[model samples]
Each structure stands twice: as C-alpha cells, then as structure tokens.
Target: MDRSANLVSFEKIRKAAALIKGAVLETPCLPAPRLSQLTGADVFVKYENMQVTGAFKERGALVKLDSLGDDEKKRGVIAVSAGNHAQGVAYHAGRLGIPATIVMPVLTPFVKISATRGYGAEVVLAGNTLAEAKAEADRLAEENNLVWVHPYDDVHVIHGQGTVAMEMLAAQPDLDVLVVPIGGGGLIAGMVTAAKAINPNVEVIGVETTLYPGMWGAFYGKEVRCEGATIAEGIAVRDIGEITTEVVKKAVDDVLLVSESSIERAINAYLTLQRTIAEGAGAAGLAALLTDPDRFAGKRVGLVLCGGNIDPRLLSKIVVRELARDGKLVSIRIDTPDRPGTLGEIATVIGDMQGNVVDVEHHRLFLNVPAKGATLDVSFEAFDRPHGERIVAALRDRGFVVRYLEIGDRMD
Candidate 1:
C-alpha cells in the first residue's frame, strides 16, 4: 500500500478487519437517544469503550504486532504511551509471547501503569511528560535491539484503527456525520480514510481538547504549540504523528476544540444520560457534538466513545463536581441562638422544604457570633437550584439569617 497518498483505502481497511478478527472486540454502535434529544440530531454512539483492555488501541496494537517478521517479534517490542497505548501493546505482545517494554511518564495515572504491568509487560517509569518518556523509549529500544512501535505513525496501526469507520458505516450506513477524537490523529485519520471510501458525503470532523491542538495545527500548516492540562488525557499529544498529519490534512473536514470544562461535563453527561462510562479522551467526540448541536441537528451523526479506563478517584471527583453543577448539592451556614431548639428549627425548615440533609455541624467557638449565638453548617441535596433557593427563602422567612457557602472559584 503506497500510503504516501495518506489514505488507508477500503481495501486495506478490509484486510485489517480480517487480520484482526478474533483478536479484538467488534465494539458495538448503539443508539444514543438521550444525546439525540440533547442535540436534536439522530445520534448513534460507537462504543469503543467495550473493546478488549477497555479501549480501541488494542485493535491497532494487535494489528501492528501481527505485521512484525519473526526476527522483529523475537527481538520484542517497545512503546511509549500515557495509558491506552501502553496497555494495548502490553496485552497484545503478551498474547503473542513477545517480550514488551513500555515506557510511561512518571505523571501517568497509577491505574494505567498498573493495568499495563498486569498484562505481563515490563513497565519503565521514566520522564515527567509524554514527550520525555517517548525519548527514553527510543533510546532503550535502540539499546535492546527491540522494534519500536510508533503509536500513531505506523501504517499497520492506522490500518487497524481504520476498522472503526468500517464498523460504524456497516452498523449505520446512513450516518451523515462521523465525529472522532484527534490526539496523535491515528484514530481520526484512519476513520477518515474508511469513511470517505464508504460514503464521500459523510462529514468526518476531528474533535480535540483546547489544551492540545496538534491535529488542528497540522491541518492548517501552522506552528501551534499543544500545551496545558486537559481532562482528555488520552489525546493529549504534544506533537502530532508524521503519517497521520498528512492523512488528517487530506481527509478531515475541520478540527474542533472543546474546553476542559465541556469535556468533564460531557464525561459526566455520558454517565448520567447515556448510562455509559467514558474516559477523558473517550468523551471528546461527544463533547464536540454537544458544543455545536445545531451544526448536526436533524442529521444522523455518529460519535465514538473511544475508551473507558478512568481511575476510581477521578470518577468520584467528576461525580461530585457534576452534582454541584446540577445544583443538587449545596452547603450553607446559619447564625442561630445557642439554644438546642435552634438546631431543631433549622433541621425542621430543611426537612419541611423536602431537602435531604447530607451533613450538619454546629460551631460556637470560631464564629463572630455572641456567646449566646452559634454557627450551624449544613449540607443538603436539593431537587434543583430553585429548590435550593426555596429552602434558603424558607430559612430567611423564618427570621434565621442564612448564607450559602461558596464552592470555590470554579466558573463552570
């Protein structure tokens, strides 16, 4: 395949489909009715989250490894990744009985590193950022005579990733728009190749985090730096892939960026509305969809939920932040007389307002209140913002001074 044209042609994608059969999951494309309602579009979600190892990278890793000659395989493999790619290479290499060494940055999430090691691959924790880690991997691969696998640059990897578009179009042939996340551009470039082959009319849009616009810079031939922290860590490539840069430039319609807040909210929304768990990168496609719902309105659009290997601690934080966003959780303090019935009075007002009290504490020593007065801190889950306001109104109406606690300076 003369890939200089930057196309992973239908023929190549089909071959990849056959090559990776039984090696990876044929992740399902499901109807996203809730997302459709939110966007006024016929939305379908490609659940790559269900892929083996809980991500789509397995497809590319397996395909790439499968292409290696016996000597290359004997020499083993080395790769640099934040998480998903590391696990993909480790799992597939272990399955092939090929020794694997994965180099990941120190800041890489513990869950990802653990999962990669659990796949029977040696993990080297080196460097502080992905770029630094990748440099270390290159040096080690040279030293060990191992075949270094470029996560997004290799043709076999791109071919494997192309299968996603094949599945999407097969599951829903009339899909008018295909929204995919753009990190190093392996996924989107491959998707664009297969999608354009199947249906030229289908608009293939690449979604990216505002923090890292690698693909965007490549598409426009601009020297933009990809920096800043983003929730979509899966696609936080500081540099775009060389091969994928060409592919995306030729095939992708336009690259779109979404704020970290939007990405976080999309992750939460997918859990709440679609009943699906999406890692930061997995949620970027849907984030773009939500950002410009009207652009896809009334059309059949497909978005890929690319991965779901989020850490438990991060998940807990997202849940709490979402609850705060919905106005369901609130904190407040009240000045009350030091009498025991004063606590009962506030509790009665909250109970009467049908708010579920989550916690309450009385402070007498740290407040500016008189010796006869106390400060009561209360936490509750209200039905909505109005319900929370109503409870505050009820307290004020009863002559008890009440003030809502500030939940930090989070704008969203």
Candidate 2:
C-alpha cells in the first residue's frame, strides 16, 4: 500500500497540545543520569507512564473524544484494545459523559479489563487477539450508532500523540534524536511530525520488538514473521497503520529492532536504576540503546517510557530472573546425608558466608538420591556474583556435593 505523507501537520498537533493542556498531564521529559550511564548516551526519559491511566494513550483518546459531535457523544463511543488504549478511551469517555464500550480480547489481562470497566465503559470480551477484538468493536460501533475511536489509525489520535513531542522540545530544546517504540505507529508517527516540524535536523527513530516487526517490515517492503509471546505486548502489533506508515516513512530517520532479552534488561534497569516501572513496550527505546550503545553514544537521545501497566506477577518474575542471571540470586542443590544435623550445618555455613536463604526444598525420597542421602535445593540471595561464588566455595570445602542451578533448570 502506497502511504501518503503529510496527512498530519504541526498546526494540528499544536492545536491538540492546547486542547489537551489541562485535561492531560504534561509528563516530564527530564535527564536520566542512571540511564545515561547504562546506555553510554546523554539520555533523557519522558515519563508518559505518569499519566492517570498509566500510558501515553490518554492524550490521543482525549483529543478524539473532544472532537466528537454532541450527537455522537450522546450516541456513545466504542474502541478495541486489551491494554492502555482501552483504559484511555474508557477514562476520558466517562469524564466527558459519553457512553463508552471497549471490546477486548478474551485473554486480556484482568487488571486492564477491570480498570476499563471501573472507568465506566462497558467491556465486551470477544475473540482471542487484538485483531479479533477489533472486529467485534467495529460491528458494535456500526450496529449501535457509536463513534469508532480507533486506537492508532485516526488523524485526531496521531495529532494528540504528537503533543508529547511538543512538550519534550519545549522542555529541552537541544535533543538530537527521539527513540520511540512503534506498535501500530501512532506514537512515532505523531512524534516524527512534531519533531521534524520544530527542528528539521532532529532525528526520530522507532523501536520495535523483533518478535513483531510490522513497521520494520513495512519500511523494507518485505514480509517478516510477526508472532511471538513478547514481554513488550503493548507494541506487539502485526499490522502498521495506513496513515501512520506514511508519516513514519517520511519523517522517521530509522526503525530498529530489539530482542526480547534486551527488553527484559531494559525493564530491569528501569526498576533498579530509575526506581520506576516500565512496561515491556515502554522500555523498548532503552532496549535498542542497550543493543547498540555506540549508535547513540554522545548524543542527547530522548526515550519515552510509554506505559507502566505491567502485572505485579510478571514484574516480580522479571526482577527475580534478572537477579538470578546477575548471580545476585542463585539456586543450588546439595547432596547431604539424611541425618538430622545435616540441614542445620549447611544452613549455618550459608549464613556464615553471607548467603541469605529465601527458599528450600528437600528431596530425600527421589530416585536421583541415594537411600541414606537427601538432595537439598536451596535458593539464596548473595551480595553479587563473587560473593555467590565464595558461598559455593565455602559449601564445597565442607565436602558436600553441590551443584548450581540456572533459573530455567529450577523452574517447575
């Protein structure tokens, strides 16, 4: 499909910026010293996760809602999303006294589904993927005379999303490039227009998870595989928006792909260094920087942490997995005589070595263990990798058969 550039302009974006002034939070675009250290670039991070709905989707959703005719508002609005966009539309629609219906995938996260409904939008769980949910949403909109508020494809949505760039440049005028995550391309498309319009020399780059490289594939005019269980599900879009693709091609300087592990590292970095929570898609920009540090070294690169809607369970898993990978957390199985004093003696050794045991499992009756021996699997927290090694060495000096277990090996 040939996409037309110039479908959105700076003036419309400025108007959107004005319209959403008091309605949306003017999210901070501040220097990230820790991220700068990690990425080897002078990095600034935009905290769009600070928005009430914990996403940048609020800006676009509000603008689209405000643009609706009174009759349309009376008739209501409908949207399809399983994440931030659903919350954004539901939140603003409730505030504006418009009836809203959100169609989400059946497997949508419980937190998201409840949050959208709490904002007073009726949630219909239909289909299995976002594409299928959208089909249901489209049908409902046409059947009920409801305005269809598209998550990323609409002009108003793009204009509103551009407001982030306006605020970024206003706060820090000398940014060399913007590193934004691309899903259906609304955020980057809007950002590219505003950034280029303000300063033609400023570069805009889009980041996509390697699992779903829709925009990346579009740029190269080849079909790339687009399906996987990505942690960055927010940007796991298989299709690029028509209007957004046009602006992206013209204004975006580059589109890069980051691997799943890179994204996981970025999320862990955000939590540890920045003391902030970033959803997988939100951390993609930083993931790209981690993947290729020299590409952005010495440049004032801006990263948009787009959302913070990750589940607590998932966040804990990511954090613990990172700790295990870093050797701060470890699991070890020790072959021990099935004597009463054996558990106490090993636990004492670990404590004396400064290893704090968090969990333990004893397998005395397992086929792998000798009749008079038990396999004790213990999980411990160490100060660091070397400290963990010291603890292991201390246990080994005691003549106990010990083996370290990787996270994957320990998972049941």
Candidate 3:
C-alpha cells in the first residue's frame, strides 16, 4: 500500500485517540521543574515510557493490530525495528491473538529482543542496521503472505502517534512549543498536525541527533549521510518515511540537529534531576533544549520522553560517564618516581581531602616516562566540580605531575 499519498488529518488523529483509548496507557504529561531550571525553558515532559512496552510505539502498534482483519490477523503481522516498535507490535499483537514476527538488526540490544520474545512474538535477527532488517522483513512478509505493520510510514501509525499530542494538550493547554524527536518522522508528523490544529500559534520543532539527520535532511531538502553507532540508536534511521516526510514538510516549523554529547547530557539530566530513565532518542527533545537553550528560553516547551528501552549496562556506563563529565568522578594519571610510598602519598592526599579512591592502576617502563619514574592512574569520587579541582590542586601542590584523564580523553 502507498501510504505516502494518505496524509493524516487532525480528525483522523482524534479518531485514533478514541479507538486506542482503553488499549494503551495514558502516559503522564507533567511539569519538570529541574529540567526547566537546567534548560532556561519552562519545561513539561510527556512520559510515553510509562507504557507497558516502555514507549509511544504502543499506541501505533495497538491501532494497527486492532484494525487488522480476521484473515490478516490469522496470516500474522510482520514488522522491522531494533527497539521500541518491535516490542510494541509484539506486545499488542500478542494481546489481540495475532501471530507477530519481528525482524531486528543483529546488533539490537538483547534486552529489547528478549522483551519482544517474552510477548510471544517470533524474533528474527537479520542484517546489521534497521534498513537491512526492514528489507528482511519485507522478504519474510512476501514469502509468508503476512500483513505488513510499517512502524512509521502507515497512516494508522501516524494517527496513533498523534494521540500523544492530544493527551498532552488536554492536560496542559498552555504550552507554547512542542519539541518532538524525529527518527522516521512519524511522531513529529502526528504531533505537529495535532498541535497546529489545536493552537496554530504553537511552534512545532523537530529534533534529530547529529549522527542520523534523516528527518532533518528530509525537512530541509538536503542529502546528508546518516551513519554512526550513536547512543540514541532508537532514532538512528538512515531513511525517513515517505508519509511522514510529506506530513513533516507541510507542518513542521523547524528541525534542530543535536550532538551526541547533548543527548547524553539530557539522558543524565532526566535520570538525576527528574528521577526518570530516557534512552538516547527519548532524550533528543531535551537535548535540543540543552544545546540551544537560548532558542527555547522563556517559552513553555513540551518534550516527549519517547522511550526508556535502554539496556541496563549501557545506562550504568552513561551515568558514570556523565558523572565524570560533571566532575563528580575523576580519573587522573600521575607520573612519580618508582617508589612504593609515592602511590600511598597521592592516595593519602586524596583521602585527607575526603575524596574516596575508586580505582588504581600502576604503569612502569612507559617510553614517555623517565627511566626511574613510574605512572600511576588513580580514579576517585568527588562531591562536585570544586571538590575535584581541590583534589587535583592538592596533588599538584605535592609536586607530582598530575594529568586528568577525564577531560583529556573523551570517547567520540
């Protein structure tokens, strides 16, 4: 079916809101005081991660599943996703007693794959990226005569995602700007439609990570390469949806491209400040706020925390890395003479300053170091940036060559 020709109207979104009301969770749309303080914008967050499948995809998946015919349901539904969409389709399809087949990239997180399988869908790992997985899904669907459940391209999915904007406006009608993340553009397309119809004056902004600017390119008519293993892998689409591109081209006010650091900062901010979990794509809207705070200053902004399907291990690393960036954690390398008490002396200075040592590494015979001297890498926890600086200062006063690893060496 050519869904590109079928544009989603506000009325269709309202109908979808009504049809999928009881089937999906009505996630909270509430004020975020800390986020507001951190970003210079009056911020409100729509918690789509509260859904059973931990994403907004549940709405679109349920609408698509429920709209299936008996024969179509019997033949099964096939979809391509590496994250939330796969789980959403698997979960709701299982609920509707429809067989579900999910094709995911081979490198897709195990947590997402397990969750989809737990919902009784047959999971297939194929290709190396979302587009390749999609190709595999198309092949499987044609072979098995399965019904296709396009994640973002179908009219039903776009309308389904629009319900989030409806619920947000119903709860907080005074929002001046709606900032939504764009992967294949469905969420922003639906949201811009609803938001513009409700308040024509309300600004609709689309956010994309710098690594994958598919929607940004589509919105601005540019041909840019979309590559990289970004932390926000959920929005790592190389191709934008035809239907969504059409809607976005007409409705979106502007698209903001945010860097990976901004996204990581946003995720950490959500975790520490809001006491919530936000995956990379889920944090894109807030990332835009962080990277370009001036643009949103004084405006009441609505941010969609689209999904929280991040792997636990990845989340832990991100949190620690953020702490390092914030100076709450410090890893410093010291060049000292090959003496036993030299390491103890540095440790004592840190301990005296009330810093807790986290890790210690000893290196000898490095070409850069003097023949008589050895290198010691010490990691410690600090209360804050000032405290970390104080620790470094104390070590410097002791006449040791101290170099901070956190600031000097950052992963790109």
Best by TM-score: 2
Provide the lDDT at 210 for model 3. 92
lDDT of 3 by residue, 219-250 (tens): 78888999998988899999888888888888
- Candidate 3 collision pairs: none
Descending-TM-score candidate ranking: 2, 3, 1
TM-score of candidate 1 on Cα atoms, chains taken together: 0.94
Give the runs in model 1 whose Cα sits over 4 Å from its true position: 1-7, 367-372, 408-412
lDDT of 1: 0.87
TM-score of each: 0.94, 0.97, 0.96
Model 2 regions more than 4 Å off: 1-5, 408-412
Better of 1 and 2 by TM-score: 2
What's the C-alpha lDDT at position 210 in model 1?
A: 85
Cα lDDT of all candidates, in order? Answer: 0.87, 0.91, 0.90
* Backbone clashes in model 1, listed as residue pairs: none
Worst-scoring 10-residue span by lDDT in model 2: 1-10
